[model samples]
Target: MIVLGVNLKKIFNNHFQKYIFLYFLVIVFLMIGISTGAITIRTVDDTAREQIINYLGSFSSIISKDADLNTIKVFRYSITNNIQTIIAIWLLGITVIGVPIVLIIIALRGFIIGFTVAFFIKEFKIKGLTLSLLYLLPQNVFLIFGFIVTSVISILFSISILKNRINVIRRPSFLNRFVNYTITMFIISIIIIIGSLVESFTTPIFLKVINNYLTVFMK
Candidate 1:
């Protein structure tokens, strides 16, 4: 029993080390995406900047006036978008050619996040910072977590496929992996839904509370 316990500890540590490396790789890609996104803000042409400024002004006005947002529609849209993304990742994992795409998806998500925060801060200064925080933080906590997890697992499954291509696992082990991969992706989908709920319901309220204070920055 003691020997078995020690072997289990060793296996756990081995897995931790392996996954930590993968996690680090994913994080690096995410950061690169973010940096690229932030820098892209500075590269925007004057025409585009003006258009963005106009859009932000309009959005700010809506928030400040407490205009009705179609939360249900927003919820459905968010769910649909995330579901598409999740399904893409799941499919990619199966194809084993999706490793690069999976990483790119993570990077893309990071890019969007960075661009959003940078755009706000660039335009509104401190006020923009507040708006960005209120707008993104609540929902992103879950969304980003889901993104990272899904990306890593998808990549891992893809890698497993490659490694086992030459030396296939036993039937039960293969079935276990397939089930695990599918089930885990579904769980991540559920998590993304929670993030969507936050985005639709809670984020609006958060924005509403600060909309009055944000009007000054609109002009």
Candidate 2:
């Protein structure tokens, strides 16, 4: 019994370490994409810059006016979009090709975030930085956490599937494991949804406050 306990402890430790390593690996990939995105934003041609700014301005205008009404629309849109991505990651885990796809999705998410922050900072300087931190970071921090956790689990499951195919790991209650995975994913989905709600409902209020501050400061 003591030997069995020791063996289990070792296995748990190994798995924990692997999960940590994978988490950081994913973060590194995300950072690479983020840096690239920031650089791209900084170097884009004037026409492209104008287009991007105009697009962002339109979104801001919508949010600035009738924030309460737009909050519902934003919540619906954000949650739907997030759910689709989560579903894709879950579905893709069943296939061998999903590993790379998951990585790409994570990196793309990071790139979008980096580009947005860069754009704001470039255009508005300190005010942009403040907005990015207040308006963007609050919800995104949770969303990123969800994405990283989901991606790690999805990749691990995919690897498990591959190992099962090759008989590298003994098959024991695969169905049970899968059911647990599904439940876990559902819980993580809820977390992401909460983040969306924060972004949709809470962020606009922050934006309004910031806008008011800027107005007074400029005056």
Candidate 3:
């Protein structure tokens, strides 16, 4: 972990003075996306709210009833979804045009998390907050940290390419930098995987226990 952090720091060591503020900007966008997502839940119609409630009930039942099955299914989904997101960010980070898209992706991730958390609170009130803190926040906190690092790296690489357009690809020095970027992304992917593992195994058990105790949770 220390080595990975050191490597990531080195990748931006030279450019830090120039591009350090970009991380703050990316975080602002992410926060905007999250706040927007939470607000969106309030705008949901009564019909949509009913649907969400129904879904929650079904989800609670599934996790509570079929422990092994839920674990397998959730693990598969978490792995597939998390890996695809990672790959998309990694690939998109390769080109300058992808910079805006990377920010959008981060925003979308924040939106999803915000919406989920808001929905839980809207439905279950205090109990939902407990669930969110315990089940929703832990894995997502690490994943968000990984994503923030990845986002900053994406912006930096794109800006780096733009600043050094004179035969950037042919320059072996650029290649070394690219290697560092790739390695950093690979490490972030591992962190993402670990987050997914927590979600897959821990989430199911957490939700099952919550559901059992909070019998009046949804319906």
Candidate 4:
């Protein structure tokens, strides 16, 4: 376990520059998400909150309180999106034109997350905020980590393309390169899985209490 930690640390450290880019990117996305959410809440007011509560109540009714089905779905979707985004970014970075595509992809992801969370909060009010935490935080941890890795690779590839130095970024060891990519992806997958577990086993219960309290206060 210690060895694995060290290896991951080394990989991250070696690509510190890319990590910096990823940090800025996440921050920008988060800001956009929060602002959009606030605007949405202001526009809709209380009715939106009731709608969100109704939606959650319906969703809870359909699935088991444990959240197993939802957790699995979230895990599968997040991993697929993370891997696909990274691969797309890598392939696009091969040409100068792909740089903007890479940033666009990242930005779009941020926008979606922001919009979704904001919509929920606006629709559900205080309860929506609590529920959003249960859903967003864990999965986000994984997404951000995966984004850092992919963003770093994209940066390296983009820089090489700009300098017309493809050879500097290319390695002949295809098997080794593939292994490294797999390891990084697996790390992301693990994080998502853990998040799903939290969402499934714990978050529902947490949200239940918030809903109960709000129900009483609203009376």
Cα deviation in Å at residue 195, candidate 4? 5.5
- lDDT values, one for every candidate: 0.81, 0.81, 0.80, 0.60
The regions of model 1 sitting more than 4 angstroms off are 1-17, 57-70, 169-175, 205-219
The regions of model 2 sitting more than 4 angstroms off are 1-18, 60-68, 206-219
Colliding residue pairs in candidate 4: 48-123, 49-123
lDDT of 3 by residue, 68-164 (tens): 6666777788989978887788887788999999999989998998898898788778877888898888888778877887888877888778777
In the range 1-219, model 4's lDDT, one tens digit per residue, is: 999999989986766754676557645655665466556555665776677557656544444464465446644664565556666766775566786666666666666666667765654677668676775676566665566456555655556556644565553454565466556555555554554555555445555554564455446
Candidate 3 residue pairs in clash (backbone atoms < 3 Å): none
Worst 10 residues of 1 by lDDT: 210-219
Error of 3 at 97 (Å): 1.2
- TM-scores for the candidates: 0.81, 0.82, 0.82, 0.60
Order of all candidates by lDDT, from best down to worst? 2, 1, 3, 4
Measured by TM-score, how close is model 3 to the native structure?
0.82
Q: Write the per-residue lDDT of candidate 1 for residues 1-219, one digit (tens) a residue.
A: 999999988975785587997878888999988888988999999899878767655666676565666678678888899889999989899868899998899899889988988887887788779877777788888888788878888989988888788676532477789999999899778889999998887656655555554456454
Candidate 1's TM-score reads 0.81
Which of the two candidates, 3 or 4, achieves a greater lDDT against the reference?
Answer: 3
Off by more than 4 A, model 4: 1-11, 17-26, 33-74, 165-219
